[model samples]
Target: MTIRRALISVSDKTGIVEFSRQLAEQGVQIISTGGTFSLLEKEGVPVTGISDVTGFPEILDGRVKTLHPAVHSGLLAVRDDEEHQKAMKELGLDYIDLVVVNLYPFAQTIAKPDVTYEDAIENIDIGGPTMLRSAAKNHAFVTVVVDAADYGAVLDEIKAQGDTTLETRKRLAAKVFRHTGSYDALISDYLSKQVGEPLPERYTVTYEKVQDLRYGENPHQKAAFYRKPLAASGNITTAEQLHGKELSYNNINDANAALAVLKEFDEPAVVAVKHMNPCGVGIGTNIHEAYQKAYAADPTSIFGGIVAANRTIDAATAALLSEIFLEIIIAPDFAPEALEILTRKKNIRLLKLGEFTSAAERKPEWLVTSVDGGMLVQESDVHTISADDLKVVTNRKPTDEELKQLLFGWKVVKHVKSNAILLAKDDMTIGVGAGQMNRVGAARIAIEQAGEKSQGSVLASDAFFPMGDTLELAAKAGITAVIQPGGSVRDEESIAVANANNIAMVFTGVRHFKH
Candidate 1:
């Protein structure tokens, strides 16, 4: 197919002028719409307007410009079909050999904090996607380009072969559908949220690739990172890496876990995560003391784990952190001396995140996971419980200090995987046992990890105890109080055991099963 006339329309004008100039130099006639026509003409590239080609002026605020039969027939015509060619000639319709188009910035517009529905609706591109779909449907004859990144390659192919190859056209056509699919998905998602339909009849989500990691949980698995189009700030995806090698799959997961746990505390706090579980968490008067308490929680598990701090890391804390072999350290900011000290360990990944906020304040609308042959989507678990929400289920009520410790343990337990158990005293975590096959197994591990520290400490279970075994185990370990969601059918048995052991227990009426 020889190129004669090409249509160009785009929202992002990156590299378009140069690309149009190259096309003009190749003796290809350029027909563009509105701003693209003006831009090309201003750049000294000869261009024809859509009004000249279709004999129709843009009307209705430019919404009715390219929806004419002249544009669609030209793009949809089959070149080799004699009947289609004859109909095109009879109607004086000229074949458009190529289409360059991109949709309006609808995602970017809606991402603003104060955008209105009227503002968002006007930014939706109608003519662009229509022309793209028409050209893609007839890719055997009409070439379509949707991405700015593909401009140079398309221009090079045109310069080399006078027209793009069939294979290239097919690939570009496929890209057009994928691009528009994501575009429509964003619109659907936004409108669904606007209408108070969180989970729509047909849920759709789209993400742009952020980066390809070195590997997944294991080196044998391939993996990459992607982010939602309008994802909020102050998340692991938006964090800035100040130093060290590229983050691995495990590094990103652990970093996110560390951040989630760090957000639970408003005071100066430190959280260390290993295998996506909070192994150590502490709140203190200063970042240094927090680091000390967190390191004291479980020193062995802190090795090679990711650490996050709610407050600025000071020189003293950095000095202590550098003593350990950590995979990553993330904080809102670092003191000058702290940065200087931590930078000495060249291989450790250092991240400087801005002001941290709890995910509950600005939660993601959906949480999606892949299973077998489909996806499972649900709202994020941003549910929080206060001390007042605790319902005493045993004869012995928790003391004021025990209630505080139970709340602290509950916060830490939420981030741990099911079957999860966390033991805490004061405002620090003493032990975390996560991802066990059974609740009692997890309880045993947490108790064993706490050792002598388990005395008088509080325990938090992510979900209800299936039987009295976990309660018996906690009582044997000297756990004076326990907090858990109480919905199990064997709840009475667990409560009986708690009362028998003279241990105080509270039911949160909510569960935090992370898995």
Candidate 2:
């Protein structure tokens, strides 16, 4: 197929000038509308105004320019079809071999700090998508290009074969639909959110690729990282890497787990996570003390884990952190000498996440997961509990110190896997038992891990106890206090056992089941 004519209209003029110059050099007639026409003509390229071919001036501020039949007939008419060719000739319409178009910057426009509704509505492209769809639907004869990266390949194919091959045309057509689909989805998402529709009947979202990871959870799997177009500031994706190589799949998962735990504390904190679970969490008045307490919580499990700090990493804390072979260290900021000491290890990833701001500044977003044949979407688990929310269901009430520890343990247990048990003292986790078959098994694991430390420590369960066996097990471990969401049929049995052992048990009425 010989190239005869082309149409060019773009919002992002990344490579339109050079690509159009190549097409014009190949004796292809170029037709452009509005700003694109002025740009091409100013750049010394041979181009005709879109109105010249359509014999109609642009109306309604260029919104009604390319919607005319003069342009559609040229793009949709089949050269080999007898009736189509006859209709084109009788109407003095010519064939359009190629279409190069990109939509208006509605996403960028809405992303501004203070954009008006009228501005966003006006930026929605009408002619651009219509032109691309017309050309794409007739891909058997017409070629369409939406992405600038494809310009070189399309130009190369044209130069080599005098036209793009059928396969290349099909690929470009598929690319056009994906571009237009995402464009519409973004507009839909923005409008629905503005109108306070949390979950629309037809929901869609868009994300941009950040980078390809080394591998997924295992080396045998493939993975890449994608960021939402409007991700919250200072999130994992927004963190600036100060040293080390790109993050792996496990690294991101573990770091995310560390951040979730770190967000629960406003004081200086350190959280160590491994295998998508927090191995240890500590809170202190300063970063150095927090590091010491967290390491003391579980030194063996902290090895090769992701560590996140809610305070600036000082020289002393960095010195202690550098002694271990940690996979990643993320903090709000780092001192000059601290970076110098940590950077000595070449394989560790160091990230700075600006400041330790509260999650109240966060915008609403869906937590999505992919199942076999469908997807699941829900809001994030940001529910918080305090001493006031606790109901002293047992006859023996907790002391001041035990109540404080129970509140601290409540925050950490919510992030753990289902059938979870967390043992804590002085805001540091001494033992965390997660993902077990039953509540008793999880409690036994936590109690065993705490050992002598379990004597005065408190236990937090993610859900209600199905029976009183867990309380009996805790009683044997010398657990002083307990916190759980109590609604089980055997609640009185558990309360009786707690009273018998003088254990302070409180019902939070909040169930946190993390599967």
Candidate 3:
């Protein structure tokens, strides 16, 4: 089918003038509405208004312009079918060979911090989507274009073949449905939030692709990175990569885990993560000391791990970091001399994430996880433990210094995978046992790693101890104090074990289980 007539209506006017001029030079009649018509006419392109074809004036603030029968019949007619052709001839309806449309800025309007509900509703495009759907439904005879970025390729096809190919039309039609689906999903999400329903009866989300990663967790699987349209600022997804090789899937995962642990501290802190588990975490008066303490916590595990620092990294810290074989290093900022040294290692990934914000400052609204065939959605775990929430169950109470170390261990254990156990002293983690099958196994692993350092250190568990064995192991390891949620059926047994060993124990009344 050679090009004869085309309809153009768009909110974004980029490339429309030149595109329409090319169509006009090909002897294709241009039919437009509202601003599109005015712009095409000003550009010296011959165009006809919707009223000229539909024989009806635009009313209801331009909402009733393209909903007329003449426009729909022309777009929906099948040119190859004799009956459809006869009806079109009887109604004097011309064939609309192509449709160029883009929806209103509904997503952009609602993204504004102070946009009103009324303004959002008014920005929803009604007739534009209707025309697009009509043309897309009859893609065998009609061509539809929704994205302005595809204008050049589409114009080239039309100029070479006098019309778009059947394959191109089909692909364009599929794109139209995808465009409308995402548009409607954004509107649904906005309205649901307006009514205070963060999770609706039917949840729908759309993401724009950020980049395709080198590979997934392994070398064979393919993966890409995507971000929500209105994502909050200062997140790992928004971090800027200053210098390094492309990030692999595992690199991003470990980096994100490191950042989460780093956010728990307000002072200069460093968190070293391996396999998405915190191997070492430490806080110091300066970033250099913090890095040294964290590295000393577990030198073997820190060999190929990712490190995240809450403060700017200085030249001394950078010099030490370069001595290790690390996959990635993330910090709020890097001093000029520090960058000069770190950039020497071309393969090490360095990210500059400015001004770390705690979860309390910019909390996520929901936590979404994917399963085999379904999705699980729930509120994010942002609960914080305080001194008042602690319940001392054992006869012996923790001293003020022990209480501080217990809280520090508690924060670090939350980021570790369950069954998780962490040992800490002086606000620095000495040992971490993560992803064990049983609480006793995790406790033993952490105790063994701590060695003689376990003496006078406090232990934190992600959940309550299931039985007295974990407490018995901690007692033998010389663990002085422990913090855990106390709701297990065997809580009394564990308390008895703690009392027998004269170990101070506190119940947080909250669990921090990570999977």
Top candidate (lDDT): 3
Find the candidate with the highest TM-score and give its number: 1
lDDT of 1 by residue, 392-482 (tens): 9899999999998898888789999999999999689997889999999999999999999999999999999999999999888998999
Model 2 bad stretches (over 4 Å):
355-357, 360-364
lDDT agreement of model 1 with the native = 0.91
| Model 3 TM-score (2 dp) | 0.94
> How would the candidate models be sorted by TM-score, starting from the highest?
1, 3, 2
State the C-alpha lDDT per candidate.
Answer: 0.91, 0.90, 0.91
lDDT of 2 by residue, 1-515 (tens): 97779999999999899999999988889999999999999999999999999999999888899998999999888779999999998988899999999999998899888999999999999899999999999999999999999999988888887899889889999988888988998899888978999688887877778999888989999999988876665669889999997899888888888988888888888999988777898999899998888888889999999999999999999999999999999999999999999999998999998864574444335898989987888998888877888899988899999998998899889989988999999779999999998999999888888889998999999999999999999999999999999999989999999999999999999999998
lDDT of 3 by residue, 273-305 (tens): 999999989999999999998998999999999
Per-residue lDDT of 346 in model 3: 86
Q: Which ten residues in a row have the lowest lDDT in candidate 1?
A: 356-365
Worst 10 residues of 3 by lDDT: 356-365
Q: Which stretches of candidate 3 lie over 4 Å from their true place?
A: none
Give every collision pair in model 2: none
